[model samples]
Target: MGRNTRKRRTPLATKIVAGAAALAVGGGGLVWANFYASAHEDHGGHNRTRSAGAQVATIDCPDVGQKIRDVPDRARGEVDGELATMDSQITDAYQRLATTRRAQAGDSQFVQNSILGPLKDRRKAIIDRIQLEINRAGGRADDNLDELAGCQGRPADQQQDGGGQNGGGQDDGQNGGDQNQDDNGNGVAGPVADDFIDINDVQPNSRNSRNGLAADGDGGSTGTFTTDCGVNENNLFNSDNLIAAPGVDNGAHHTHDYVGNQDNDAFSSDEDLANADTSCQNQGDKSTYYWPVLRLQDGTQEFDANDQGGGAEGNIGKILKPAQAELKFVGSQQGDVVAMPKFLRIITGDAKSFTNGDANANTSWSCSGFEDRQVTDKYPLCPEGSQVLRTTNFQSCWDGQNIDSANHRDHMAFVQEDGSCPEGFQAVPQLQVRLAYDIPTPTVENGQVQNPYAVDSFPEQLHKPITDHNDFINVMDENLMNEVVDCINRGEDCQ
Candidate 1:
């Protein structure tokens, strides 16, 4: 298949700052609640305070949606609506926290009694509705749903625990990028100095070495199939996530750049997506591909700057269009790939990883010329002549039964270290997305950042790079899916 040529965004001069000048990053003040355990105990009337000099940072709530793994088909709609309500609750709570910083400084328990306590009560009610839906659908609701009700506040002086995951980076920040607390870029919502790292300092192949995920060059399908979906040049943008919050407007709470299917939104149904015109060159493929828009915190507000999913939610700045959006499917190393079921939805990476932990993180950031060195937590500061790259590999193993799951993830699994699907899971063509951007290099110095770049996220997630993610819904006709599998099994690259 012939590929369409695209004009890349003009390059910017990259500035390299010495590591010796790296600032000492303070704690990010994010919460850490468990899916089935309470991170705090409600004390009656008494105020609870942090250590002598500690300050409240952000609220972290155990993601109720991720915890509910057994939603019956009949109850999914109601459950999804309730879950979206919970997200909005958190967003509102975060907004209050950001605005009441002065009160928080005076009263340590202000966040608890005035903010978190109220938020918890609202979430508890929503969780009750979810439980009612599940029981009504003849599914046994988890008894511990109450545990996910309460959210905790993290302190600005307490740091996040470190881990050795593929996408995990030093939680305290590394290399350099000044942390500014003012109302500059996203203000308290983040991309804080700690969220960025100089790409030059990252070790080459560090991700593959840590996760034991290096591909083994053994047998099976060795071919590739590519789809040319223009890089959102049509300006398709929205904050509605039909997969997660169908029928709810602004469900994502963040703006997304869409490239494939034109009819995807909070109200788009399977039929709507199937009948939609696609940006892909092949008319048979109407798959929808999208992810949070990347923006430069240069103070230029885009159209949605005041809209719920944009600046109003702290996703402020001028949105940067991708220089290139490459969508391709590759064969498994250990087996022939099966055709994917149409309308199969897949979400890669955790969009709330800043507060949700790195367990579900699946994104990598790097410079075009230095792809070998990737970081999961920090936005890569690319060098001159190199563009920033965001890459994600979708799950390539299916359950062979369900195209969707309760949590939107249980139906698909990533390949094992040996490149084989888990038992009962079948190998399928892996969808790989690579997005590139060219923008002015951000200036980081003396505890301040000018013109920083960040991915849009939930108000509470703080625009952290670990929260970067991608979404896909395969709307391909049977013929296109079959061709993809055949191309991979035959060792031929087709676009």
Candidate 2:
């Protein structure tokens, strides 16, 4: 696995949180509608995933397959139509914002989103029907995670909302009270009321607050290269779709980016990567960087058929300007050299989704105006003048030569605790990204509460708690890449 690692070109898609869903799904443009549903046989393990056979391009999650079974054959067509429609509308919203001023609506632009949307009502109805199927399958709608059918590998898709897959180990979906309930045994009466994890509860433990998150806080000679990567307003919604590289775009359970080389994908080559124009300020820098798109939860925007999940979810949001991209390599006390590869593909934070515990949760929730008070996991509603922010850091340690690895991860390792490079690995300028939002909470369902304020994740990450993740495909010029490396080797900080 060390010297013989094969170069597997990994899509930014696979490296997220739990490998269950992200590893199994693929992305593309609007062409997903041409594919068939995923069919499953038994696959075992906590990380169980099924790649489509050479001939089949479909999302294959055994758990989601079970949930799909909940949809009666009679309703399958309708549900597909409904989901497809929602997808089209969501795509259109991003297309509109492609040229318009892109920004998360401010406080005045905020309001609780209603469960009324073409997709929501149908989605909820489908879930109801799915519950009936569960009963027929000898399962209950409110069945605890233990009783849920299929693999329990990835529980991320079920984060906040009460459902069969939430995995919070607390909620029973509907009846008998689970998730967040009082002594009386009823599901938490309201959405934001009991369901939202208090800000104070998770802030002290933020992964972003971890000692090595930024430049080595523990102290060491830091070789750094800083740049203002200019805010990127590209259509990153393609995260779950095919991008970053080519050929495999079908129906992604999640999203990923194909930055730098405009022609990246499963088919991209070194030449193609070296020739693309970048979205960054450096016209000479052809590096392509991408992550999941963050959309505004503006409820005023409405979709057809009362579906809040689609166009109602609002357009794709924007990455702030002054991107302040700093690629610094912290060396040991001796100030040993560490430089990253020019065209490395990096994914930081657990992009794959999971829930039910504090184990795999990677969130640094906090207010924009109050960065020092950053919290973790469940976010408390931001105070009046503040907004929420999500941060991501990509893998930086490099093996010095191979541009990529079979698993996509082994090529680059995170910096060591002492802020030194691993024995065989050098270092690259680290890429850290932060996204901000002013998401409004959801309305009280039926005068009580049900759903939590959720971020729009690609399908596999469906309706989960807000967790931030990102992907980077380094398509920098060979000369610039070497320059950064030289700057580091000389122990100098450069922009």
Candidate 3:
């Protein structure tokens, strides 16, 4: 468990970046070396599979999970180098992120947006390097992150009690229920007719039962629309487009699905996005709605265990497009759907869920061909013809005013039992996203998959499959919103 304390970052970005350069050139040469050369090296060939009897155990303080002792020497050394340098820098930056000043007003927006997000990127990059080394070393990583260089994250129960002290344990955004439970714990359906099943729910018919439910309303005023954002192609082209808060040109922390605005980021003005080209088929509709990219991993992919670098470009390298992009929009439950303001940044889900075992990762998994079975703790190993599927739903009720909030979540609330917006907020178009993929069956060791599954995430994710979630933002043109309002107010079904 993590101790309750505020983590302070004393390292400057320049020092970390420069130190990273020095390490690449063998500057600190073993000065910070923490691991001894694995005795298992030269054991004949590379990619040697470990025997089921291979021993794995956690070392001491700072390190957390059960470490695999069968790693190759070269790969172990590579991972160690990153741990001493990049991982060290990442730890410092993460402390800075937890304590940084939030809320950008006017011109200060530049610094406010630039601060933590960049650190997030750097941390993710460093972690990606570690994951790659582990993959090359021929060892699967344990999701508990017990093998991290100096990071000692507390369990969720400890995190909740520790108040998220220095350099470990996130707040997890949980209330009432245990945040550590899968998929945010027993999900409460919002005002939508039939919301998708929470990915981590273990109950049977979790998917099928909900799929059959119909959205009911006064038959006028509000309407929901879903679109297909084609699966992403393999490329470094930035797609994590929140365009605000940690505003960068290419969606710095993670990539996203861009509908409008050729150039989008936190600094982008509504006019710029409205005038820019779009990737969406609705050319007249200059709106950007995006969440994290979902991917299917083969054993060869360098991954941490959870979806860390949420963007498709950086850590994931290239991602095979999902079978479909399930995008749904919602308006008021009883009144006419109102028009959304231009350049609205509405984020949902925890993009960093790749590293957590809390409610944020409350995921539900399934197989493409086998729809009846749904698993929560771990994804079902898809058969020869089936593909693994993942889905996440965001909160809907809003405070009726604030476009963005301090924590980015306080202003939003989930709909009540009847699908009505909470007392203080009116419903806008609720955005629920779904992603599909094809994955290879992982190697099982001691009754567990050895190769950690990675989402485009940072090195610390530990590759735990249970931790899965996403984020979102809505940047729509004024006219396009009017069309949405019109469709909802008049009960017209238009794509």
Candidate 4:
């Protein structure tokens, strides 16, 4: 079909324009590619212009992965260290407990002959050392655990910038910010963390919940004696004996287990016996047995027999005289002495006259005879013959004559015009004149004697004679019982 539309010779202008346009487009495309490459390079080979929602290609960093991996190892090491410290602390506590137990035993010294003293000391030392170690280890373990817990992985952004002052962020890394801010917009500091680890936190067998250390068993310590045993503080601390000497036995004839020389004995002293010893047989025996006599309110004279006789009587009252001007007499022995039933009332005239016609003669006296005798056919016109009637009889009694050799017959009594007590004499229990029989020999051991009688039995022939009438009246007073009880409780010697 050769419609050769005469191939018009192409216009040089159009062809040149078309060629230039093609060249321009190719150059522009090349410039765009270069710009893209340059942008990617600027952004560390990342798409700088990518939208937030666009999918991104991931790139791995060998250094970062290694750093992340090292974190767990560090944490594990910390935990191991903490465990080691805990073990050390537990061991120390056990050691200390053992040591304390040992030392305490030695220190107590319950038995003086025991060889456990050294062991006790060693135990104490060990306990002290263990306590110190536990304290140190506990603190260390606590710190290490806290550090490990705080080092848990933080958000990637927070890690890059170093975690906030309080470690992870305010929102717990959900949102990064200061977490310690108060409602007033003021920043508050974190809690003061505990530095010491409690054993209870980790160990199931911890003794932290146990009570304080047990008390020492032996009562060697003064503290224990007072607090535990209720012993008197003075007795425990000063080493004083709680049991004083068993004083004189009055009001009964009894034997003492611990006997000593009757002289200067603490239990047998006249003063001590009167005050402390309540048991005396011849409590009111002024002529023979001597004791401190006290005047009671009812016009009666009372004395503690226990004060007069040592270990012969238990704590009890012994009345001496019954009424005024009443005289009592004993046998004609050296130790025989008359007991006055009551205090005497001196009268004037022939009643006070002397037999030898001497105005001041001691012959005219109220006398107690050994036995009531009638004016006998053998001796008429003679005054009643008292056992100590004549001076000869008096001398014989003083010389310890044919009376029972076992009795204390050396005691004698005489009338004095002035009614003055003998030299070195004080008011004592009025004496009882009796026939001397068998007097037990003093045991004399450890400077004292023990009482042979049971504590409950009363002795024989021991009478509570009333010398002062006023004392008799007061004894029946309603408040007398209360007073006696009070005196006894107060440690007052009540005769």
How well does each candidate superpose onto the true structure, as a TM-score? Answer: 0.85, 0.54, 0.55, 0.13
Any runs in candidate 3 off by more than 4 Å, and if so which? Answer: 1-152, 155-202, 206-223, 233-236, 239-245, 248-261, 265-267, 294-318, 331-336, 354-364, 369-377, 443-453, 465-467
Best model number under TM-score: 1
> How many steric overlaps does candidate 4 have?
69
lDDT of 1 by residue, 50-142 (tens): 221234456678888888888889889888889999998888787666555445545657778898889989999999989999999999999
Model 3: per-residue Cα lDDT over 1-495, one tens digit each: 011122222211112222221121111110111101111233444422121001111101232111333334455434434444543344344323222212111122322244434544554565566556666667664443423433332222222211111334322211212212211100100001111222334455754222111236565355666554445432223432332233222233333444334544434455555576666566665555544444333222322111223211223323445666666665555565455555445554343333333333434567776556665445565666676676655665667675554334555665665666668876666566656676554444332233223343332332234434555545565667677667766666666
RMSD in order of candidates: 10.2, 16.6, 17.1, 52.7
lDDT of 2 by residue, 217-285 (tens): 335445665544444445433323222222333223333333444544434555666675666565556
Ranking by lDDT: 1, 3, 2, 4
Which residue runs of candidate 1 sit more than 4 Å off their true CA positions? Answer: 1-53, 156-188, 208-216
After best superposition, candidate 2 residue 289: deviation in angstroms? 1.4
Question: On lDDT, who's better, 1 or 3?
Answer: 1
- What residue runs in model 4 are displaced by over 4 Å at the alpha carbon? 1-247, 251-320, 325-397, 400-407, 410-495
State the RMSD for candidate 1: 10.2
* CA-lDDT, candidates in order: 0.73, 0.39, 0.40, 0.19
Per residue, candidate 4 scores C-alpha lDDT tens digits across 406-464 of: 11111222322232234432211121212111111212133222111011111110111
True-structure RMSD for candidate 3:
17.1
